[model samples]
Target: MSAGEQHGGRVTIRQVAVHAGVSEAAVSYALNGRPGVSEQTRARVLAAARELGWAPNIAARSLGTARANAVGMVLVRPPRVMVVDSFFTQMLSGVEAELNRAEVALVLHLVDAFEQTIDVYRRWYAGRAVDGVILTDLRHDDPRPAALRDIGLPGALIGGGPDDFDLCGLSSVDADVAGTARGILGYLRALRHRDVARVAGPADLLHTAQRDAAYAAAADDLGDLRYRVVHTNYSAADGMRATRELLSTAGPPTALVFDNDVMAAAALRVAHEMGLAVPADFSVVAWDDSDLCQITVPEITAMVQTPALQAELTARALLRALAGGEPTHVVLPAGTLTARGSTRPPKRLG
Candidate 1:
């Protein structure tokens, strides 16, 4: 029987090599697009393989290539937050959708500390369990990017900005956080809210710093504005606490901005408990438009970040890095502010 009919049509590399009158190594180099084979030899081997219907063994190919066909993602977040937060769930969904198209697997690990997250990276590298990693929750002066470089592992950062592109020579995916912050300030100003308070996330987070700086700059540009920012852990309980303190202060802000939907929902409860009518006594704004934001008594006005699209872009950037491409910085369009029933001109600006 001809090489084409060998092993019931499951032609092997050896059969292709024999048919082309070349070494099996030459066939392999040619098939893998490596440099060992000359152009003429490569052409002949390719033709022979096609004629013989030779199909590569994926497992063998991966072993020879030292490729895991998988990527790792280590998140330094509380397990409780990850389970209850739709932001992370949507992010994972988007990342998985793109990776699925490339036939790649995702290894996800959630930890309470940054050190443990780094340890997971080291272990993953030693075991050759992943081709690269995806980083999230970028922090100020973060060390993980440098650590990945030291480990000789490729990675991409999510929530990066233009200024962060050169961080540890890694790829990055970002949104226009600064612009969004300024836009929110302007929108609130237009609603005649002169004194506003922002209940922000962790102060150490890079995005938080960016938003804080932007808010300060915008507030300065808009003269006669009074604003204060309270740092929290992006939790509902913290949100209620911060809101209660700000509302009970001697000179309370007429408007409150929360870093997340859960926090804004908590603020709504605090307002109710304090006998303050939303948008009449105070206004509420949230950063991410989640389901909770929509179902509140007075639907919350929010900044809309398309988490799915951002995560997909992040996955794509990491995949490109794995393919020997130069590190890329992808910045999606700035998030838009969606107004709902939760905001209006303050009765009397403080």
Candidate 2:
């Protein structure tokens, strides 16, 4: 016998069968822990295995189980840039927490482009590399959910709209974007600001569309309040550029609202460079309040979006979806507004 076969004493199923006084097939069933073998036969097989010091091949056992014991996550952007966003980080932390409790591992894949994201999902589903998937950064007409549905794989969306595309009733968790926008507008209107300017994120995002629509509806309801909307790429640099352009206009708005804290902080810096005072000269309010809110000179008053809570809910929804439950739509209420020094009654124009 070869060294590889001899070291363990060539303890094959036939040998176990002879030692246990059972047929080879019965020994095989018992050794594999299959249900066909009687209890007495199984115990005899185990005793023979112990005497021979034989062990089942781990690789073969795993193949028999046919389970990866891991969940996949696909981020629709560059990993480095996505990690910088506190919202993503917090949400991921929440996912990790839940996954840890379940003793499962998270397999994260970052696709730099949209096409790449689609390809990654396709391959993952075909390969059966994960038990389920988590989809993030939903666009207006996302294809991942459909692909997952076609493949008969379980998945959950982190952000999506009610009427937006879904893959055969896949579960989705949406942030209260409309309510968030309305809350911000209500706060500004309550402060007696008649004109408000908004720096919005990418128009392709469903949340951005929802926010924009809500803001427009609120402004119309207020009666006589002027509204200006500027769409940007949700980056600090874009926010700074938009703020500069908006402030330099012929009739600059008295108050500015940003869709994210990164842009809001950039707007604060722009205000400082232009020698404009916060609140006294202009009021500002930011959505998705994060650490950046407190870092600026005049702390920004912002609408808080709890990423941790979103993540927890998303994890639970995904688990339920994986278990073949009906699709669930959870709409968490909008976060409370944290009042800071960045907003006040608009100043009198000269």
- Candidate models: Cα lDDT each: 0.84, 0.78
Candidate 2 TM-score to native: 0.81
Kindly provide the TM-score of model 1 when superposed on the true structure, using C-alpha atoms: 0.82
Instruction: Give the runs in model 1 whose Cα sits over 4 Å from its true position.
Output: 1-63, 79-83, 161-166
The alpha-carbon RMSD values of the candidates against the true structure, listed in the order shown, are 6.4, 6.6
Model 1, range 1-350, lDDT digits (tens) per residue?
A: 36536655667777777899998888877776556778899999998877876675642453277667788998876635533498888999989988987768899887888878778989999988898998888776778888999999999877784363347878878888877778888999998889999999989788888788878888998897899999998878888999999999998999999888899989989988999989899999998888888898999999988888888888899989898999988778778999999999999855
Per residue, candidate 2 scores C-alpha lDDT tens digits across 85-115 of: 8887888998888777655678999767777
Angstrom error of the Cα, residue 279, model 2: value is 1.4
What are the clashing pairs of model 1? Answer: none
lDDT at residue 38 of model 2 (Cα atoms):
75
Residue pairs whose backbone atoms clash in candidate 2: none
TM of each candidate vs. truth: 0.82, 0.81
